[model samples]
Target: MSLFNIFNVSASGMSAQSVRLNTTASNLANANSVASSAGETYRARQPVFAAEMAKANQGQVGTGVQIKGIVESDKPMLKEYMPDHPMADKEGFIYKPNVNVMEEMANMISASRSYQMNVQVADAAKSMLQQTLRIGKS
Candidate 1:
């Protein structure tokens, strides 16, 4: 592995964490949304990440992370009886999304922290590389 590969690995991690943060934000935004039925209810979304291996480096892959896809939560939505609710069904019951605000907020914080950590790691690597360049300079 080359010294520059460190930047690539950290960049991939930061990109993956960004997608995670976006999904978490989306889930939190729709946490209070309501639907008359399950079909219309909003489900939480999560990003699936996978690591990419470097064939040239060795059998062991470098830290290259990629988003596989976004998956929706399978948990059931909450059903509430609100006859006056605008989105209520014929039976006067409204279906609220199963999203948990606290959980989503926690996920957001985690992603944010991970992103910051990656940025720090990249910055540290850059500083080290710059210092190395001064080794042979007058």
Candidate 2:
């Protein structure tokens, strides 16, 4: 692979990580949100990523990562009998989101680290290119 490919790969990684971080942040923000019914309750969301391939002279080569889509978790929502709650249903039951605070926090941390790593990779590639250009100079 060429040095230019490193920049593309790193950029894709950073974009994917950004989406993941945003999804995790949204999930965490709604972790404690309560709703009157199951349909109205928030569900944890996850970003789907896939390897992007490009047609090259040597058949196919991986270009970078791509975001396929975002999916909502199927985990059962937390149902609690809180009669005094303002958003309780007719049966005095309140519905909470299925989002797990701990899990979302961990995912956020991982995404953030991945983004930082990608940035480092791109920076390294840029420095290498600059040094290569200066090699022929006085």
Worst lDDT run of 10 residues, candidate 2, spans: 53-62
For model 2, the local distance difference test gives 0.91
Per-model tally of clashing residue pairs: 0, 0
List runs of model 1 lying over 4 Å from the truth.
54-61
After TM-score superposition, the amount by which residue 75's alpha carbon in candidate 1 deviates from its true location, in angstroms, is 0.3
Model 1: lDDT of residue 47: 94
Worst 10 residues of 1 by lDDT: 53-62
lDDT of 1 by residue, 94-133 (tens): 9988888998888999999999998998899899888889
Candidate 1 — number of clashing residue pairs?
0
Candidate achieving the largest TM-score: 2
Q: What is the C-alpha RMSD of each candidate to the true structure, in Å?
A: 1.7, 1.7
